[model samples]
Target: MTTMLGVLLRVYLVLGFALEVQTFVRLYVLSTPIAALTPSLSDPALDNVPAFRRLYAVYCISLGLLRLAAAVDIKNKGLLAALAIVHVVEAAFSIAEVLVFQHVPPQALLDEPHLKTTGFLALLVAQALLFAYGYMTASTIKSKMHEW
Candidate 1:
């Protein structure tokens, strides 16, 4: 069980890190306009977006740390519960972002929206699964504590 939990944590950390990097490169190095990346939100001043990005970066960093900590503290029900809550929140946010915002017109709208929406939905499902697994892990840990 510990091994499985560790694997899940590492997977999420890797994925989250990749996304953070991709978003940064797309927004800055690639010279892709911010509107292209964040089509859902009304076009905002570059300055405002930067702050949000920075905060998001920080959150991702924390997520990585939390995953590592969860692996170490696998027996801690409280920690697992907290992590599950966070995952659910993230999933909800991703779903809402896709549904509420019109992505900048992709040259190939069907292909892009189809792919993006599918990917986002997949992420949401994955996150929900992880959250459920985490909650179960937490309950197991809690029950084991009573046994001890």
Candidate 2:
């Protein structure tokens, strides 16, 4: 039976990957929903929606790919350890997002009233959980004498 932690980890990865891919698709492809995605909950003066949205898409895709790889090789201490580092770094960025930092701007439309409250909260929680899970899983895995 899969433990809750294991399920949570996979759920986090899959949701993260799906959301990123969805954002990328909506941003670069069809415009049905993208047209309505110009969320203005933040200070427009400091936010670069297009630029940050693109960067965010790239970040999501890359992180999702890495997380997928780690999930595939969860038993490898090396991979898990590396993923743990990545998760912490990503969590830092996510924290910046929560704080409304321009360095980590919100993805376009993701902060809209419709999805704003629940979605943003979920992202924050998921980031924290993933970071904790990553570190714990990495430390618990087998590793060489010098490996992390």
Give the runs in model 2 whose Cα sits over 4 Å from its true position.
1-4, 31-51, 78-87, 94-122, 139-148
Lowest-lDDT window of 10 residues in candidate 1? 139-148
lDDT per residue (tens digit) for residues 1-148 in model 1: 6455645554665565566566666655555655465434334564367676666546755766665565556556566677778878877775566555544343433475457555555666686677567667665544443321
Best by TM-score: 1
Give each model's clash number. 0, 0
Check candidate 1 and list the clashing pairs. none
lDDT of 1 at 42: 33
Tens digits of per-residue lDDT, candidate 2, 28-87, equal: 565323323433224443334667656655765776776676566555556556666765
Residue 135 error, candidate 1, Å: 1.8
lDDT of 1 at 66: 64
For candidate 2, give the lDDT of residue 123.
58
Name the regions of candidate 1 deviating beyond 4 angstroms.
1-48, 103-112, 139-148
TM-score against truth, every candidate: 0.58, 0.54
Error of 1 at 104 (Å): 11
lDDT (CA) for every model shown? Answer: 0.59, 0.54
Note each model's CA RMSD in angstroms: 6.0, 7.3
